[model samples]
Target: MPDAHPHPEPSPAHPRPEPFLARTAPEALHDLRARLRATRWPDAPEDAGWSLGTDLAYLRELVTYWAEEFDWPAQEAALARLPRFRVPVGGLGIHYVHARAVAPTGPVLPLVLSHGWPDSFWRYSKVVPLLTDPGAHGADPADAFDVVVPDMPGYGYSDRPTGAPLDSIAVAGLWAELMDVLGYERFGAAGGDVGSHVSRYLALDHPDRVVAVHRTDAGVPRFFGDPAELAPEEHAWLEGGAAWGAAEGAYAAMHRTKPQTAAFGLTDSPAGLAAWIVEKLRSWSDCGGDIERSYTKDEILTNVTLYWLTETIGSSMRMYHANAAIAPAQLSRRVEVPSGFSIFPGDLVRPPRAWLHRVANAVRVTEPERGGHFAPFEEPELYARELRAFFRPYRAAAAS
Candidate 1:
């Protein structure tokens, strides 16, 4: 192996750090509340609940909480306490939270976390502290991690892509550089949804730097041989995922093809934005058809409010279009790095161990009973434990 943290910052292509401070002006908050109050809702089907989409009755209740009860100032203040900063990566300023290890002398591991759509660094906020200070959280101090959570380009506070299309591979490259910017030579990668795709690429393309990889998904499964090659369970899991997509993946097709058109309504109408994101949050969560089972009014609204306040809905949609252009090499490349998988019972797709081993050198795998799409947000303690356990074998001083 060569020097992973091979050099200091001023990464040949980008120089100078651009720190970020997250804040929302009084005008923005007031405007959001006014829009919520002035919303003109659509009529619900006579007996419909969430069958058609986001339940109309539920949306109204959520909107009311968002407008009058939810507190943006308090949430903003809470987030500001995280060690947030910005730095140029590939000519764009990226916002990230870098929470250093808070453990006593032992192994020091740098772990970079990535988040998926309808969310950003907010997705990993709760788990960062626990991972950094496992001792305080009643976990092994030897399992502590120096965590870095970045807002993907065009998502959250990160600058949106411009001029050309930006896909997951590109984002992985940027994240690789970001670790270098923070002076970490060897690190581990973890994420879900789009972030899962990015993690796969990070390990595939930069295996030397990414010591190990962990993900909530194995990305889109690919099978070329006869169905007989797979076990009955594997075969069923593949077919099941495909069937689930056929039934519920319309939003993705629209995102890949007509995002710009959808953006017009989402970017302009707060209600439209809420409907677009809230539906996925409700459906994908393991809340057993009741959205409240997975998230509180404040929790749900806070994420929705971030998208509304930042006006990044359009750019976020554009990611689907960008990913559509992925080269075959990036898509088919094997993840040679040590990989781990945590299959949650309620997640939309939970492939068996055999399926995961086909994609990567899966070293560890577990099935936690709780959680859904947003594992870190839904079950922070469990999420942190999984990451700590998976990365324990690779923990050491930063690569040099």
Candidate 2:
């Protein structure tokens, strides 16, 4: 692979990226294992089976495996193998993976992949390599990308904001600066979950710098405009989103309203962390009630373990509170940049074409049969293909 590190700093005042490798100390692992083993597990009624929340029996089994069999060292070693770096962006040390396209047959576009809550850059780990080296993956080398996956503030290895949690727009500003530091004047952006909102802001705020934008979910539907003006399909989509929220939005509401309170329990108890995250992994995936069908025990544990080791569950959730403050006009702003959407069938809610057009310059939209909310992680191959095809026409924008 070609070196993807940024060019020499333009000035001493400008901070340069330092190579980063995530090495958890021995004591941290020891404490994590002990915490998993010492959990004061609660009981669930027989046949409760995910009707209420995380199944106690399944959690116990998962926690037992986490305590005894899961290997953090191996997982950490795998993570370390990626081309990782941390740079000072706006006083915070932001961590990201910068992988240059291998053997490009055409202009290599720079792409930034942002992640959401519960998971960090881990969301794009599998798809990064595929995007960076499409030829090796049985695709046209012209479709290759110089991929950058960053851990948004308060997630993964990035330092948490001290005063105010960064909303999607704030993070997007940081990304524009980060990409500038990495010598990319214009780049494509894509993400899901909270990442989708951040990517939206990137295009909305930096239309001159972002070549194009892509997203998985269109974000939770809300009316910044009059309801009577909306199409019938839009009304149906909004109604579905409301129904889904009543049943499944407790986690997000908690994140927005009381993340700090929930954080303490999740941060202190490994079992609690797993239960909180694993439930979403099951509920929001194409796993059909069997999470392991979508992700192995190792894959699931790696993400959860990163959260535990960093103790970032609280900080990550704080983004919800920050995002809740975005003005209604900003939330309703339609992205003019050429945009694409791949709405997976198993995701939280699928926005109709009219709704997408109402929100974005929807040049392309496809509803693939597989994957869900975590499409990058759930269906990386499909996700990679979605990106390559969507951004192919926009490569000229990045190059110019």
Among these predictions, the greatest TM-score belongs to 2
Residue 261 error for model 2, in Å?
Answer: 1.0
lDDT of 2 by residue, 1-400 (tens): 6644333232344687899988789998888888888999887888999999999988999999999999999999999888999999989999999888887878889999989878999999999889988999999999999989999999999999999999999999999999888878888999999999999999999999998999998999898767899999999999999999998999999999999999989988999999999999999999899999999999999999999988899999999999999999899899999999999998989999999998999999999889998989999999999999999999987886
Can you give the lDDT of residue 300 in candidate 1? 83
Among all windows of 10 consecutive residues in model 2, the one with the lowest summed lDDT is 3-12
What does candidate 1's lDDT look like per residue over 259-348, in tens digits?
899999898888889999999998888888888888888888778888988889999988989998887756766688999998877788
Q: Per model, how many backbone clashes are there? A: 1, 0
CA lDDT of every candidate: 0.85, 0.91
Regions of candidate 2 where Cα sits further than 4 Å from its true position: 1-13
Q: Tell me the TM-score of model 2.
A: 0.97
What TM-score number comes out for model 1? 0.94
